[model samples]
Target: MFRILLGREGRVWREALAAVLAAEEDLEVVAELAHTDEVPVVAARKRPDVVVLDHALPGSLTVPDLCEKLGAALPGSVVLVLMDQRGGALSTALARLAPRVGVLTTDATPWQLVESVRQLVRGETVLDAKVAVAALTARDNPLTDRERDVLRLAADGAPAKEIATELFLSAGTVRNYLSRVIAKTGARTRIEAIRIAQASGWI
Candidate 1:
């Protein structure tokens, strides 16, 4: 039998998911967690075969960072992250977990979750088709490479002169780049432009 742990926050939602997984004759629900901090203690004690976690949690921390630690705590157990959207706020960095971590969107049926748990136990990567399509269909970044570079620094509150020094450009040129970036991002100020780009996953 495959021992499973539910690491989502909501009681009702966790129970609902538990009911779905319980139907699998080969899968067993061993524990449930409402917080990321509880994962290490429970996984160490239960040593479950799989962990089903929701990408959104109560704390300011992200589930991806928690996944790294959970994977390390139980080397034998693999993580399956459920995304609420076609593609969650998943950083481009999530590609690193492609081998041992699985990602499924919220629209997934109960059977898909069950099968994904079995597949993870078998050591397979499970990624939703919507994830692929979302990546492909994302709005293209409108900023030029240099503009992106400048905006990256500007986003961190660096002034034009400081940014110019870092990129080895003239201070006047850096200001010009910031102006163009603000216009392209359709923001009234450099700060607003940086915010827009960051929100869009461009920076």
Candidate 2:
């Protein structure tokens, strides 16, 4: 059987999708997670052959970090991410992961989702055409991965000290990161930086 791990927030949709994938004769739903924080832990333990993840799965870690963590934990596994938007930090991150990563909009039919998983296992890159085009044409995100991480926390209204505690960095380092984020976004203040990043879909 082709083992599958699923990570998505909505209980109804998650369970329904699990049922569909599980119905396949050669596919099995080995694990499911509603939060991004649990994904790395469960995925590491389960070692599934494929991971079907939702881009907006709620948790502390950003989508990029979650994807990076997944890649590190299961380098050989394929990740099929269900996304809403076509381009941004999330798509950029997924693109960097290349053939091991597959993306489809949340509106993708269940049949498309199933076929994409099989294609991924067969070593074919699967990307929605519009998603691929937007990812390629979208302006590159100016912030590095670390900058984006710090900015995501800041966007959540976390103070530098709290951000430091969460990220295991010193308060001063967090402030520096915030400063760089502000400068990179060309914002005169922290709040403005947060707004700019959000509007640009960088965070």
Candidate 3:
């Protein structure tokens, strides 16, 4: 049997995944974790052959970061990310981490999820066609790369001063980027701009 580890915050989804995996003849869920912070520990203990992760966890860490870390920690393991249909950033980040990992949409049927997991176990990357099309059809932003970077930092809940410090720009420059992002996204406030940029997959 292929051992698997599951990571997701939602109790209902976790239960559903467990039920689906349990019914598979060749797959076994060796462990399940609720938070990204617990993933490393659980992985170290379980040493599963595959890890199915949810991308909507509450933390500063992104799915790509988790995949990178897990890849390092368990060189023989494969990471498969489960993302919401509208999770643009998650899709972009997973795409960037391709070949090392694969992505599946939450709307996927149980059979699809099991098949994706099997594909990942065979060292193949699988991306849902609808999710791929959605990513391609997302709006392209007019903001410069630096402006997008600033907006992403803001979306991660970083303050303007911290963002400026991290980007090595003056606070005023950070504010200017925020203003440009707001205007490009047609949002009234920085928070709204961040949300819009994230939703459009610009960041």
Candidate 4:
């Protein structure tokens, strides 16, 4: 049998997913979790062959970090992530983590979910067609880590000096980073760049 563990919130939809997989004679729903942190402890005991992950699950680590932890602990286990948006940090970073990762949107059909799970068990990678195209066509996020940090603080209405004080950098250096952020985002001003980054899910 192909055992599955669901790591997600939205109890109603998750249970509906369980019902769908339960119809398959060779599939079993081993466990369901409301948070990402539960996966390590609960899944360690169950040793499920697959895990259905949600993008919003809470943990001390980020989504990609949790995936790495699960991948290492579960050995041959794989993940089928229910994507929230078409592109974001999680989707962008996925390729670097688990080769067996399956990406799909919440709007995907039940049949698609089932097929993806089966493909995962067969050691194949699955990505929704829309996700594939968006990920392929999306512009590479241009902001570096420090640039993103400086811009994120700026977005929160922090003045350059306050940002520099918080990050332990000189005021002039903060302005330079802000200028690069504006140019990279093709925005007219810092506020505009912040809007672009927030809209693109980069900050």
Candidate 5:
């Protein structure tokens, strides 16, 4: 059986999807979660073959960052992300994850979901055609590459000092970059800036 781990904030939605996947003869749910923060930890412990995550799962890290973490925790496992109608803020960085990271719309049938999981486990890429086209044609990134670097670290809950250290810059410079990011995104705060950048697929 293929060990599966699921992460979605909605109680009803998570369990319902779990039931659908579990009913399949070749799959077994090793773990289920309601928060993105729990995914890497649980997945590390369970060592599941596939992890299915919802983009809206409540947590500090964005879906892409969380997926990176999960990948590091279990390099052999694959991820199948369920995107909302707005394409769940698909990004170029995400597309780079390729076969290790599959994408599907939330409206996909239960059969599609099950098959996608199996395909991911079989080392096949499963990207929704519509979302891929939409993401490719989306607006260009507004922030500079440096600004995006800072915001990406910020999205992962890194403090200004930590971001500065990682980027080999001063903390004040990091803060300045964050401030510019917020202004460029027309956001009221740092978190809002990160969200705007993510939703716009800028980072």
Candidate 6:
């Protein structure tokens, strides 16, 4: 049997996923975690073969950090992301974290979920074709490389001065890049501009 750890913040989804996995003859859900911070601990304890994580977890634990931590703790374990239909940005971000990660739509049938789990257990990465195409087509990056670097740092809630220091540019230069990004994305403020850029896969 393939041991699994399910992670989700919402009670309803957690229960539903547990039930689905329990019905499988070759899968066993050994732990269910409610917070991202709990993942590493529980996974370490249970030594699960795969971890199924919901994208909507709380706290400052970004998906990348979660994947890295889990991989470090359990070298051979696979991390699969459970995302909603609209979670394009989150999918993109998670893709950058680990190559073994895959995204599955929440609306997928229980059979699909079980099959995906089986694929992960066999060291295969499985992303729905539609989600992969949508994510790739959405990669309409309009900003220049430098502008994207500035925008990404800004989106992480960094100040203009700090971003300038990190990017080795003057603060005024960073401001200029931000202005152009704002105009290009048709956003009224820096935060809105970052949001638009991220949504469109420009950052």
Q: How many clashes in each candidate?
A: 0, 0, 0, 0, 0, 0
Indicate the TM-score of model 1.
0.66
TM-score of each: 0.66, 0.74, 0.73, 0.70, 0.72, 0.69
Model 4 lDDT, full chain set? 0.79
Question: Looking at candidate 4, what is the lDDT of residue 69?
Answer: 87
lDDT of 2 at 71: 80
Q: List the pairs of residues colliding in candidate 5.
A: none
Query: 46, model 5: CA deviation in Å?
Result: 0.7
Greater lDDT among 4 and 6 belongs to 4
Measured with C-alpha atoms, the lDDT of residue 87 in candidate 6 is: 48
lDDT of 4 by residue, 1-203 (tens): 99999977678977988998888888999998887667889989999998888865644445566778888888799988887564565466775553578888888888888888999889887877766665665567898767876876798799999989866789999999999999999999888899888777565
lDDT for each residue of candidate 6 in 118-149, tens digit (9 for 90 to 100): 88777777787666755666655567757776
lDDT of each: 0.77, 0.83, 0.79, 0.79, 0.83, 0.78
Q: What is the per-residue lDDT of model 1 for residues 106-163, given as tens digits with 9 covering 90 to 100? A: 7899989999888888888788887655545546678775677787678778888988
lDDT of 5 at 92: 54
What tens digits encode model 5's per-residue C-alpha lDDT throughout 61-155? 66788888878878999999887545424545567798999988889999999999999999999888866875786677778756777887899
RMSD for each of the candidates: 9.4, 3.5, 5.4, 6.2, 5.9, 6.9
Stretches > 4 Å off in candidate 5: 143-182, 186-203
What is the Cα-based TM-score of model 5? 0.72
Superposed by TM-score, candidate 6 places the C-alpha of residue 185 at a distance from the truth, in angstroms, of 5.9
What lDDT tens digits, residue by residue, belong to model 2 across residues 1-203? Answer: 88999998789999999998998998999998998888888988899999998876767776667877888889889889888664465676787776888888778888999999999998899887766665765676898767877877787788989888877789999999999988888999999998887766676
- For residue 39, give model 2's deviation from the true position in Å: 4.2
Give the distance in Å from residue 145's predicted Cα in candidate 5 to where it truly belongs. 13
Better of 1 and 6 by lDDT: 6
